[model samples]
Target: MPATSHPTRAAVAWRWVALVLALSQLAAPAVTSALAGDFLASGATNRALITPAGYAFGLWGVITVLSAVTAVVIVRYGLGSWWETGILIDICIVFVGFSLWLVIAAQSWLWVSVVVFGVMVGALAHVMRKLIRHRDDLTCPSWAATLATVTFGLYLGWSSIAWFANVAAAFLDEGWSAEGWWWQFVVLVLASVSAIGVTLMLRGTLGYVAGVLWALVAIAVGAAQRGSPVLVSTAAVAAVVVAVVAAVTWQRLGRRARISPATA
Candidate 1:
């Protein structure tokens, strides 16, 4: 019998679905840009303190590259197990939803952007939970597991912070008073706490933590550019605190992974 005949109909169907989703990862950026107009300009129109530096948005390029890498990984190895397939589905939702978000934002539907972000982040969170729970799955080789986890982890981490920023921008668009510096401080504090909480929950996945740290540092830089000394200091402190927790969590996860090698 041919090797292709071994998989059942469902397995074959899944392979095709996985391949399409992986390709979508590569296509998302171009489609998003075409439909959404200039994301940075849109962001600037309703900018808030939580907003990171314009350059910080460049992380999307890193993500796109990682997505390309993930696409190649999936094609080369195939979906090794249901766990991987599920993660792929959730990630596709994120990419598609994010494109939708930019389109909506372009129309100045600020509240709608918030809701869209909420949905996208929820999908990302689902992927994170699955990755954390199945970290040691023997069905997936080390390289596949690492690549998937890191890719999704980065997505979730950035989306987590982006969600808060979306909400703030929405509020600002409504002419909600951000008159005082204190409100921005409060939001920054809340974001930091939330990032740290998620990091601890995920056992310090390096990719996710790196995403969070990247956004936080970028937020500080943006604040500096805006000449808000107080905001800059607060964001910097938050980044440092999250970094410490992430370092510890990453170490712990590594130790656990080594001990449990094949014991997902």
Candidate 2:
């Protein structure tokens, strides 16, 4: 009758679901790519890529690794604690639903893809709230929860931005092109918002790292598009500046946490 004695039915069910979803994601790039090529060749869409963010999609692998680590951590804890149970359920719901939706959207139903991505963002945000609220109870040495939380936040935030970019690109390809500096303005706005949100979520060193990654990806994309070299360079420089600030902030927070009796 002990809480940690054996795996509950819910836990076993979720484990199976997670296993299947993880395998599906592993197979996704090949499957989705083939389907996308077919769609483009048939003139269903003018695009040649499955994701708007290009190489940014690799972050999903990082997410999957983190999720696997989290699952291990949860199992090690014996699932006695409500916090572990809650986190496990949240992750299973998020990953399984998110992966299936992306596969379907990439293969077909391009327009409805946006809604699927939105649901993912919402699911991850819920997980974030849970983590922050129960940060004190998370004492796993692997730091799985913390790492997963931040990684998921970064992925979701960047994915949201990429979604908007994809939608805009699709519209433009459909003869809704922007004029003057409108597209640039739109990209800048989206990047700024995403950067700010990431900064708030990550805070300190991790935040700085996340910010630099985001800024670099943005600049790289701009440069690849043959955008103004000066503008791209400026973005790169700005990213470095934000990175420095984030490092300093992270260090300060670490120092404070170390000195605090609770952390001590």
Candidate 3:
């Protein structure tokens, strides 16, 4: 990939553009408040049987703040050179799509927002998946590339579950009935299992683990508030198990990387 394909005369400036885009969340949240009588909205607490408690949405704030940091360091480390032209372009598209998704969400375009969100997820996942393999493509410091990878991984991981909940809400909105309380409970349990299953199969990345753990714990908390012990226990157990795996994986990986050449 030639630098001409993606290089900017002002790499830092382009990064600021991306960072500002990330900050657009300062606007009214796409997830409308239930108090506003918009329960059908994408972010509303009452959107679905699987919809998490309102408190769970606070994770967005944290994810965005960290993303801002990632955006900055990525350029400083050399975003233009860190990624191939295609990847760089896709990353830009992801930012633009993310902004659009929020805009559509604010309009209560539930289904449209889901489509936009899926696009953003796909783009981001592409960047995250190819990131480590392309480390040699980077002109930035090694730490910068690693940090950006982890940051995106965390956001991507959480967004994975959010997408799941989003789809569940959309279907429920479209009259997909649970059919019974037992089936409803079963669905939620399946969701918990799916979350853990994905996390376990994910490449060895602590950020993915972190994001999944946070979402699962919040899911558990949300279910508890809703008085669903089955979902609560399911989510809580999955979260704990995932957390332990993340810790152990991080420890082992860190140790192996630190091994002296002679010790190998």
Candidate 4:
């Protein structure tokens, strides 16, 4: 791969860009809060059944720290591989989209924010999938690449549940009440299933599983507090199911790792 060659100036520039973007997330809470409200406050104001508790939003802090660390790793060790370059570009897009989302949300463009959030998720997912698929192929330090992969994986995992919450909030904004809405519960089920599916597909990437589980657990907690017993039950069930799937995925990944070395 071309990444096996010397890192080019362009690659170095992208690496720095990625690093800047990562650090900028540390400011997102203050910036977004000033523009409108903090992310959790905004979601709470536009309450939805799937909206997680305030504690869940704390994941943003964790993700921000991990992102900064990953960016520094990439800048230090990125080998100009195509995947490295692609990831840098995609991650930048995610952060830019997030800034745009804050503006859109401030304007109370709930529907528009929905669309923008989807695009951000897609971009993050692409970066994460690429890193996972090509992890072993990268010419960069494997530990560095793995850290980058986990950072994006965690981002994507959180976005999976968040996207649904965003959709539910949009519906509420448009005056669509959850009252008498059996289908809303169905949507929650779908959200859980989707999380499980992604974890399975990713072969139990630990960061991804951790992110999804964190959100789901928070959903259950928030639902119980909000007196949405049905949502609480659904989210609890989903969390368990996701845990089981992740365990299976880990086993499979372990088996693959064991067998591949023998074949080699």
Question: How many pairs collide in each candidate, listed in order?
Answer: 0, 2, 0, 0
Candidate closer to the true structure by lDDT (higher is better), 2 or 3: 3
Q: Which has the greatest TM-score?
A: 4
Give the per-residue lDDT digits (tens) of candidate 2, residues 1-264.
222345567766665565566556656556766766434334323231221234555666766665566555555543343455655566666676666655665565655665666666566656666565465555544365566556655655555555554454455455553432455445645554555555556564252356245635664565445444544554455466556666776788878888897755
* C-alpha TM-scores of all predictions: 0.84, 0.69, 0.76, 0.91
Question: What tens digits encode model 4's per-residue C-alpha lDDT throughout 61-130?
Answer: 8888898888888888884465567767888888777777777777778889889989988888788777
Give the Å shift of residue 150 in candidate 1.
1.0
Runs in model 2 with CA error above 4 Å? 1-12, 38-55, 72-81, 104-110, 139-142, 150-154, 178-181, 204-219, 228-245, 262-264
Could you list the CA RMSD of all candidates, in the order they appear?
A: 4.2, 5.0, 4.5, 2.2
Tell me the spans in candidate 4 whose CA falls farther than 4 Å from its real position.
1-4, 37-46, 178-181
> What is the alpha-carbon lDDT of model 1 when measured against the actual structure?
0.74
- Residue by residue across 163-240, what tens digits does model 3's lDDT show? 666666556657676333355556556655765665555555777777777777877777766667777777778778
TM-score of 3: 0.76
Candidate No. with top lDDT:
4
Worst 10 residues of 3 by lDDT: 33-42
Weakest 10 consecutive residues of candidate 4 by summed lDDT: 37-46
Tens-digit lDDT track for model 1 on 1-264?
112223335544555565565556566667766876677565633367667888877787787678667766655665455465666666667776766776777777878888988887788888788767765542545777788789878978887888787777777776765544677778778888999888888877878988998888998887777678898998899888888998887787778889897786
Clashes of 1: 0
The 0-to-1 C-alpha lDDT of every candidate, in the order given, reads 0.74, 0.54, 0.65, 0.79
Give the better candidate number (2 or 4) by TM-score. 4
